[model samples]
Structures are given as structure tokens and as C-alpha cells.
Target: MMIDFMTLRADFPLLQQKNRGKPLVYLDSGATNQKPQSVIDAMNQYYISDNANIHRGVYELSERATYQYEKVRHDIKEFINAAHTEEIIFTAGTTAGINLVAQSYGRSKLKVLDEIIVSAMEHHSNIVPWQLLAEQVGANLRVVPITDNGEMDLEAYEKLFTARTKIVAIAHASNALGTINPLKQMIQIAHAHNVPVLVDGAQAFPHMPVDVQDLDCDFYTFSSHKAYGPTGVGVLYGKQKLLEKMPPYQGGGDMIESVTFARTTYSKLPFKFEAGTPNISGVIGFGAAIRYLQQVGMQNIAVHEAELLAYATQQLVTIPGLKIIGTAAEKVGVISFVLDGVHPHDIGTILDDHGIAVRAGHHCAMPVMERFNVPATVRASFGLYNTHADIDALVSGLKDVLRLFK
Candidate 1:
């Protein structure tokens, strides 16, 4: 069944709001998605009826809360097609998830002079953690260059892999360029070199179907907020063998089986990395978000987003002196473009006056912006609830801005 945009919009309260007597047009899902009522209600219901710290208490409320919290783990496992629930570890967000792997796996497995490969288009979250890990361990960070068309240089990437390459961490999709990387092929190449690959799925997860098993990536991370869930909750999915071999990411109450001044034994998989009290309600709300996506069907969502992107791109090209930053054959719904003689900040402010919200600036991808020789670009990203009308509104706003500037 085709997704009904009007019905979907009805589920999001923010879409109903008036901005300067105009309907709100949100085109910033790449930064963060607006929550649906189901997600909000799920969180509120949990807090109102089942608010309690999990795992330690014997009371009914605590037990129910613990069960609900753990249920999200199972939900995530199913969401990603992970082999086991134990492979799903909830963290603060994508940054925290990547850091957990770097501190645990990178510190233990990587040696001095070993190389970690990342792409030039990576977000700072993917780049900085590896940089810190390399600094700490005396490892080398190798960056794969991108084509002028904004896709990763896969040929160059293949040449960068060697016996010394211990890990390859790359984004599943370029948040700045909207270029979807060839992850399955990248995984195959990395595995041939016996290197484990970690994919930052923060952008891709929202727009496409991601099966870690199908991609065969060693590690996958994404933020719930990007997936229409609450903030402060994210997921890290790793192969059980790799996670078991890696050391614990943190030391705390739920992470330990027993503690002695002499020796401390850590808990098993998942918990060993999730040290403290997690975002219970946030995780539960994430489960609701996942459920919502499942009902909408990711395949349908992808098709809808692709149509919107093509429509937006076509109309955007009609505007005089506007150039899209990325022109990759494979892409998500994210459209980053620049207008001649206009700063992205000015474009963003002008659009805001029309009740159209879009992102401006480097998008936490300074290296990509530097590669393109631009300081920033205006980014408009689509979501499941978005329609062709939203793109029309954005194009109309852009035309007005162009007229004003000219």
C-alpha cells in the first residue's frame, strides 16, 4: 500500500502547527526528525505508569520497567536483524557508540603503526574517535578520498587497504553529500584483508533498510533521534565474537558480575558496554518509533523519499545560479546545494521567514565542505511524513530568496 502523506502528517503534531500563518515545512530530518504522536505517547505512558529504575528493584513497577527496557533491546535486535539480543548495546548516541568500539576494540586489538581507514566525507563523530584512538595507540589514520561527484573513491579505498589496515570505519551514507556508499562491497573488500569494518548508519538508517547481517559489517551504529525516536538513545550492533573479544567500554554497577579489590569480573555481552543506568524511557520510545517505521514499511518510505528528492532536485536546478553539491548516482533524500553569491546562513534565514526549515553550514562535515571548496551549503532532507508539497514550498521559498538577492 502506498503511504498516505496526509494521514502520516496527522500523526505528527508539529506538522499541524502554523508558522507566520503558514503551514510548517520541516526539511531538516537529516539533523533530527520530529517525533510522531505514537512515540511521544509511548514515552509519556512509560513515565506515568511504569517509571522506575530497572534491574535492581524487586517491586512490580521496577520489574515491569526492566522488562520494558529490555524489550527495546529485543526490538533493536529484530530491527537490525542482529543474530542475538546480546549484540545490541544501548548508548547515549552515535558518538558514544563509536567511542565504545574505539576504546574497547581499537585499544585492545589495534597496535602501534596499524592503520584505520575512514572516508573524507565522514562526520566528525566518525573521524574524531578514530583520531583519538590513533593518537592513544600510535596508529595511523588513512582517509579515503571522494570523487569530484561527491561519492567515495572506491578505487582509492581498495588501494588503501593492506595487511596493516586493522579497521575501516566509514559512513553508510554521506550526511553532507547524500551519497550512499557501497557498503556491501566495502565490507567484502575489507573482509578479504581480514579487517573489520564499522559503518556509521546515522543518516542511512532513516532513509533506507539496513540489515547489518546482509551488509556483513562488523559494527553498525545509529541514533534514535535521527530515526524519529527520543534523544539520548542510540544503538550499537556488533558481531558477538568481536564484542566478546573486546574489553568492556566502561566500569559501573550493571556492567559487573562481581567486584573485588583484587579482581573485577565484568558482565557478559551488551551490559559490559552499557555501564550505567541507561535511558530507559528513551529506549522504549525508540522501540515505538521502530514499530511506527515497520508499519509504514521502509521500502515504501525509501520510494517516497526518492521521488521527493528527484522532484526537489529537478526544481532546484531550474533556479538560476543554484548548484547541487553532490551528484552521485546513488543517494538518499538529502539535497545540499548552494546559490551563487549567497551565504548558506542567509538562505536559511530567508527560508525561515517563509516557515520553511532547512539546515545550513558545514553539517559537521568540514572536510567534505573543504573538499568542495565551499564553507557551507543549504541542506533539505526529507522524511516519511514529508510530501511533494513540502518540496514545492521549499522551491518557492528559494525562488523568493533568489529574487530578493538578485
Candidate 2:
């Protein structure tokens, strides 16, 4: 079925606005996606009609709100093929999710002389938490190297595992370079040595289908804001046994079943991890965002973005002195590049003059820049609503940028 790009674009009110006297060309989806009208309306509906705290109220509005909130959890479980809804724990965002695992699971399992394995392309969120965990537990952190093309070195990854290895955390896709890692093989290798794998899926969730069960990963994390949903909400999926074993990340209200000065018992699977009041409006709106993706179809979105990537790559490479970064054999629609003699910040500023929105800098993955020996690169990322015309305008904007700099 053909994706009606025009119809999809209509759902986003921000996309309708003009920028700098030119039509808006949004290519910064890797950072955060623009929210659609459905997501906006859903949040408004919650506040307008269903505003109530969940899990402890018997009132009508509270019941309705609770039901809607839990419904999103179920939907996400099915979306990712998680084993059960109990496994889906809602948090503020991906950073919170990873930190929860790093602190709780790390404190519980890691010990002196233990090791944590991670890849070189990780965003700061994925890297810093483990670094802290290693410091706290007196464990060593091992990094898996990447090939020059930005693909993970599977051979090198296998060699990193040792008797001391406790866990493996990695990104499903590179936020800066758009390189999708081979998660299946990586997980298999980790499991051979009895290590569980955790995937940082912030960049991969919106652009592709994710099945935690199929990947056999013990834990997976992603943010709703990256997928056209509201900010301040995200999901963490962990296998039931693993989640049951790990202690509560925080001590607070809803997470506790009974509280006393002497002893406090925690609630069941999900609520055990979800402490205090949640972003009710955000979760309901995220449900709407997921429904939007379902209606549009993820398969169709992937095809559309792949075509856009190929066309844009062909056009952008024609510009002399422009070098594309992370040319992995398999990648998502993101294109990161360096134009000779122009700083990435300047490229971003110039593109904005042409009404093109792109991300510049290390993209929270300084190790990636260090590996490539570049301070930063200008990144043009795609979303389901992005069109071929957007790509054209981006290439045209780059030409304009070149004229000014070169």
C-alpha cells in the first residue's frame, strides 16, 4: 500500500508552519520528533475530561484514567512483543530507564572485579550510567570497537566477554551515524557466556519495528518523544524473572505496597519500578502516538524512509568535499556528514537560514566523534512524515551553505 505522505503531514500542525519564509524542512528527528495533532489532542483530552491520579482512587474519573494509562502499557507490550504487560515499566524517559537498570540491577548483581560490555557508538546516556555502575561496584567497563564504516565489530564483541562479564548494554542504532547494530548475533554471543543483554533503543524505536522477545534481549529501553509522542515519558522492558530479581530503583509512594519505619514491601512487577505520580497525560498521549503508527503502518514508513535515504545520499555525495559519515551496509534514514572547512555548528546555522532543521555537534555520542577523529558532524535524520521534497530542500540548502562557506 502506498503511504499517503500528504495525509500523514496533515496530522502534524507544526509541519504546516513556514520557517524563515521557506517551507519547513525538518531533518532533526534523531534528537526528538515533532508531535502530531493526535498526540496533542490525546493529552488535552486527558486533562480536560479524565484528569485524575491513578492506582489508588475509586472515583469514576480516576478509574477511567487508570484504565487508559494501563491500556498504553498493554499496547506497548504487544508492539514490542514483550512477554507480559508486567514487564513494561514507565519512566520519565530513556535516561531514567537505563539508570534504573544500571543502579538497581548493577547494585544487585555487579561486584568487585566484574565487567560490563558496551559498544563504542553509545550515546552518553548509555555510557555514563554503566561507568557509574562500574565505579560503584569496582567493576571494569569493556568497550566493543566499531569498524571504520560504523558497524559493530562482532568478532571484537565476542572477545570482550570474559568470566567477569556481568551484563551487556548496547544501542540498537547509532543516534549520530544511523548505523543499526546486529542485535541478534550480539545477544546470542552474550547469552553463550550467561550474560544478559540490554538494548538502548532510543534511536531505533520510531524508525523500525522492535520485538524484544525475538531479539532475546533481557532489557530494552526507548522514549515516547522520539516517536512523535509527548515528552517526559518512556518505557523499559525487562524479562519477568529479571525484573522480579532486581530491587526497586527508588523508594516512594505508589511503588510500595505497605510502608513502615521498620520494613516496607514493594508492589508487584510494574508498579514496583514506577515510583510516585506519573505523567498520566503523557502516557495517554503516547498511546495515541502508538495508534498513529499502527494506522500508518511501520512497514510502509520504513520503505518510505529507505527511499528517501538513498535519493538524498546520491544527491549529497555529488557535492565536492562533502563526506558522509558511518556508511555502514545497513542503516536507517539518518545522514551525518562533514563539509570541508565548515564547522558542524555553522552548517546547522546556515541550514536554518534556508528553513531546514538539522542537528549539529557530537549528538551526545562524543566517543563516536572521537573514533572518527571528527569533533562533530551535521546530521539530517528522517521521520515517517518526512518527504522526498524535504530531502530535496535539504540538498538545496546544503548547496546554499556551500556557496557561503566555500
Candidate 3:
């Protein structure tokens, strides 16, 4: 089913705003998506009516907040088709989830002779954590090289594993390149060597359906903000048996079963990893965003975004000196390009003047920038609310930028 871009665009309040008397064209959704009215209202309603701490309180308001918070976990579990809600651990965002696994699972499981496998397309979030883990544990970090087209070399990936390989951490999609990686095949290759895999699904889950069970990944992490939910809440899905074996990431109140001066006991599966007071209103709002996606449907969003991606790519390539950085066979709605002489930051400034918002920088993936041998690229990433007309605005805006520079 084709999603009505006009109707979906109306749901986002920020999309109605104007910049310099020009209507806004938001294309920075790969960083953070604009929220629907339903999500904003759901979060506001939680603060207005049910504002309280959860888990420890006995009051009705606290109980209601707790239930709503927990239901979001279940909603995500069902959304991703995970085996159980207990597998979902909420953190600040995807970076935090990766850090949790690195600190807890990596520290415990890795030995001096072990190696961790990652790809060149990894976000700094995925790379830095493992680097820290490797440095601390006296382990090696092996990077699987990418093809010129930005696709990871699967043959190279399979060859990177050996008897000492401990785990594989790779992104389900490149945030900068928009490549939808062959994760099922990658996971199978990793499993053949008895190595677990952690999929950084921050970019993948927002654009398409993610079934952890189907992928058979040991751990999957995504942030709520990228999926049109509130910031500060991320989902980390892990196999129950593995989470049970890994130690706690942080020490705090809610993550405890019992504590004394002499000895402290930890809580159960999900709680053990979740320390401190979580983002309550944010979790409820995250649930609202998931419900909103449920209404629009993931497959429909995927189809709509794919069409926009093709149209935008086709149009952007017509410019004289514009070069696209990633040209993989499969990608989502991201276009990273550089003009002949105009700097990406300059391009971004000119586009913003015309009310077209695009991202320009390393985009937190410096290694990807280094991989492409470019300092920076102007990136325009799409969302459900974006339309073909929005792409037209961007193309027209780029022409204006080019003329100004010329």
C-alpha cells in the first residue's frame, strides 16, 4: 500500500513551520525524526496527568506510569518480533546500548587471544566501544573492508573469522551510506564459527521491519529518537540466555535486587542492565510513536521511502559536479554527496536559507568519511512525511547553491 505523503506530512507539526518565509523541507531525519501530534500529545499527557517515578511507588499514578513504561517494551518486542519482552533493555540511546554490551559482555567473554569483528561502515558509536573493550582486554579489532560501492565484502567478512574470533558487531544499515546490509547472511557466517553477533539497528529499524528472531542476531540496538519517538530512550534486544550470563553495565537503585554494605545482589534479566531512573514520559511517548508506525505500517513506509530514494537519487545525479558517495545495490532514503568546489557546510547553509534542511559533516561516522576519502558530504535523509516535492525543493535549492558558488 502506498502511504499518502500529504496526510502523513500533516501529522508533523514542525513540518508546518516556515524558514525565511519559505516552507520547511526537513531532510535530516536520519539524525532525529520529527514527532507526530499523537506522539507529542501522548508524552505531554503523561506529564500533565501521570507525572511520577515508577517501580518503587505504591500510588495509582506511579502504577499507571510503570505499566505504560513497561507496555512500550512489550510493544517493541512485538514490533521487532522478539521472543520475549524481558529481552528489551532501555538505555539512553544506541551508543549507550553498545557501551553496555562492550563493558559487560565483551569484558567477560573476551580473552587475550580473542578478536572482535566490525566493518568499515560502522558509526563511531559501534567502533569506539569495541576499541575501548579491545584495549582493556588485550584483544584485537579486525575491520572487514568494503567494496568501492560501499557494500561490505561478505567474502572478506567470512574470512575475517577464525578460532579466536569472539563476536561480530555490524550495522544493519549504514547511517551515512544508507546501505541495507545483508545481516541474515552475515549472522549465519558468524554463527558458523560459534561467534555471536550484535546488530546496530539504529538506521535500519526506522526505515524497515526488523525481526531479531529472523536475523538470529545475538543483540540488536536502536534508538527511539530515530524512529519518531522521544530522545533519551533506546532499545537493546538480547537473547535471554546471553543476557543472563553477562554482568551488569551500571550500578544504581532500580537495577538492584538487594544491597548491603558487605554484599549486593543484582535484579533480574531486564532490570539488571537498566540502572537509575529511566525516561518514563519518554518511554510512554516511545510507545505512542510505535503505535503511530503500526497505523502507517512498516512495509508501506519502506515502499514509499524506496520510491523517494530512487527519485531523489535520479534527480541529484543530474547536477554537473555532484558526486554521490554511496552507490550500493540496496539502500534506504539517504543521499550523501559532494559538489565540485563548494564545501558541504556551505551547501548546507545555502540549502537552509532556502528552507531545505540537510546534514553536512562526518555524521558521527568519521571512519565512513575516511573510507570514502572525503572530509565531509552533504547528506539528505528522508522520512515518512517527506514527499517528492520536498526532493524537488532540495534539487532546486542545490542549483541555487551551485549558481551562487559559480
lDDT per residue for candidate 1 within 328-385, as digits (tens), equals: 9999999999999999999999999899999999999999999999999999998888
Give the range of the ten consecutive residues with the poorest summed lDDT in model 3.
1-10
Clashing pairs in 1: none
Predictions in order: lDDT: 0.93, 0.93, 0.94
> Following a full C-alpha superposition, what root-mean-square deviation does model 3 have from the true structure?
0.9
Candidate order by lDDT, decreasing, is: 3, 1, 2
lDDT of 1 at 247: 89
- The segments of candidate 1 whose C-alpha lies over 4 angstroms from its true place after superposition are none
TM-score of 3: 0.99
lDDT of 3 by residue, 156-242 (tens): 999999999999999999999999999999999999899999999999998998889999999999999999999999999999999
Model 2, 1-406: lDDT tens digits are: 6768767888899998888988889999999999989899999989999999999899999999999999999999999999899999999989999999999999899999999998899999999999999999899999999999999999999999899999999999999889999999899999999999999999989988888999999999999999999999999999999999999999888999899999999999999999899999999999999999988888888888888889989999998889999999888889999999989999899899899999999999999999999999999999988887898888888888889986
Candidate 3: clashing pairs of residues: none
lDDT of 1 at 123: 96
Taking all chains together, each candidate's TM-score versus the true structure is 0.99, 0.99, 0.99
Q: Show model 2 residue runs off by greater than 4 Å.
A: none
**Weakest 10 consecutive residues, lDDT, candidate 1?**
1-10
